[model samples]
Target: MKPVDEYFINQKEPYQSIMLYVRGLILNTLPEAEEKFSYKIPFYNCHNKPMVYLNILKGKDYVDVCFVQGILLEKKFPILRNDNKRKQVRSIQLKNLEDLDHENFIALLHEASHVLSHSKKAWFI
Candidate 1:
């Protein structure tokens, strides 16, 4: 695939809204996260690797926000959905602004931030 700038950069309307929504939430949570343009997508990298990635593939109807380490969250928070489609990583779908889960959504972002903070502070084993 070409660089994200060549692919997603051309998306218009709804696709941009959904992708931006997730992107805004991620930036709001980790204000200092470094943005990465890799694998034809936008990845939020912290502590050197990605914490989450937002990809808007060509022709796809919805943009995807992928938690790079979502498997751990699935194990820690059993209440987190464990649908068959979420076998590897986890994601919250947003059709519009209304699809935002607010409270739990913020919590997930915090959890990702916490994981990165700990990994950097020697708090991780």
Candidate 2:
């Protein structure tokens, strides 16, 4: 299996289901996204920017749908984890299937893609 596929296959129970659902939401939202393994996680490249990634936090029962340009979108969707320690990245921690806010998350993805596409900064990843 591809290493990225293996990443999903190895997950247990709720995390597996949550990750797969988030993966589907992200891809369905941004069909141009390029899926790859980066930093040992499933990273999606979109609009020539490091758009998003999915991974389970160590010792946590949740999966993170991390947005690379999250700082730009967080004001509109404050549900994202607000870590002052994290400058640009923000994440939505999905602990259960019920936590998936399809409409808002899809809006966030589209907004992130728009911001990244217009960014003049050299792509960092």
Candidate 3:
């Protein structure tokens, strides 16, 4: 199995389901996104640039869907949180699939892609 698949399969209940659901939302929204395992987690790349990543931080109860240039996207998406004090990376934490705002999350994904397409500098660097 692909490492990305294994990463999802290895996760425990609730978290595993949450990650899978978020993963589907991401792929369905950005069909061109490339899914790869990086930093031991699932990372999505768009237009050949890192766009987002998913992970369940140690001791954290929720799955983190982190946008690479979230700082810029935050102007439009106040839902994105920087609770960890990350400068550019902002994320939404999902404890259950019910917590996901489908329309808003998909819109955020599209916005993040837009931000990536307009910027020339690599955001992930």
Candidate 4:
């Protein structure tokens, strides 16, 4: 199986389900997105640039859906959390499947893609 598929399959309950659901939403919203395993996590690329990634941090109870150009999206997506004070990346932390707002997440995915398409920042993997 693809490592990305294994990443989801290897996850324990709740986290596994949450990641799978978000993964589906991302692919459904951004059909052109390329899924890759990087930094040992599931990363999605848009416009040939890194756009987002998913991971369950060690000792954390939630799955982090991190937007690469979050600094730009943060202005419009106040729902994104900068708890870690990451300069460019912002994330939506999901503790359970119920925490996901499907419509909003989908919108965020699209907005991220739009931002990447217009960005000239020379962002790397």
Candidate 5:
């Protein structure tokens, strides 16, 4: 299996389920995304730009679905976290299935992909 595949397959119960679901949501929304392992986590690049990434947080309680150009989409969705000292990445933390907001998640994914594809700046860098 690919390293990224192994990463997800090795996760425990609810974390596994959450990661799988988020993976589906992202791929379904952006079919062109290329999935790979970067920083030992699952990273997706869509339209030749950094798109999204998924991973289980260190404590093992949640999975973080991170958007590369999160700062642009933050105002649109309140669920996105901008806590990191770096301002470029934003993410949604999922602790359980209940935390999955399908509508908002899909919308955010689409917007993130759009920004990655259209933005002239090197947002990924």
Candidate 6:
């Protein structure tokens, strides 16, 4: 994989911190995550399907966490951001890592893993 952005490496305050928090939260909960570079951004996948993708665009105030199967989990946990664009993917944008609700984030991640696992098992039936 190409080197992660020097800016991402050099990022110290909110950006790097946010990424680290999110990275740990994401990896710890998901059982099959493998790091891959997709579209020059950091992404994680399970059984070849994307689970999480993150990007820190230049001069941007937020870090975008994609790969959200928000619609699937919303019935149980309704805290995810809901956009009109589509129902499958939801995003959690953060200005700073502190702003994220860590416990809730992890809960959502666990729910995501469970949903995928169940869906994958059902695929063979």
Please tell me which predicted candidate would have the highest TM-score against the true structure: 3
For residues 23-117, what per-residue lDDT tens digits would candidate 1 score against the true structure? 77777887878778876678887777678787654555555667766766766644344343655556555556676777777788788767766
lDDT of 4 by residue, 1-125 (tens): 99999889999999899999888888888999999999999999988888999988888889999998888888898989988878788999999988888788888888889889998762632
Per-model lDDT: 0.66, 0.84, 0.91, 0.88, 0.82, 0.68
Model 3: per-residue lDDT, tens digit, 1-125? 99999999999999999999989988988999999999999999998888999988998999999999999989799989998999799999999988888999999999899889988854653
TM-scores of the candidates are 0.72, 0.91, 0.96, 0.94, 0.90, 0.74
Q: Global lDDT for candidate 4?
A: 0.88
Q: Model 5, residue 9: displacement in angstroms?
A: 1.0
Q: Mind giving the per-residue lDDT tens digits that candidate 6 earns over 1-125?
A: 24554535766677787886787777777757776766777777766666667876576688877645666767776655554375476677788866788788888777677776666531221
lDDT of 2: 0.84
- Over 4 Å off in model 4, which ranges? 122-125
The number of clashing residue pairs in model 3 is 0
Better of 1 and 2 by TM-score: 2
Error of 5 at 103 (Å): 1.1
Weakest lDDT window of 10 consecutive positions for candidate 2: 116-125
Best by lDDT: 3
TM-score of 1: 0.72
TM for candidate 4 is 0.94
**lDDT of each residue in 1-125, candidate 2, tens digit only:** 89989999999989999988888888888999889998999999886668889978787778888888787778998988854367678899888989988898888888888888888752443
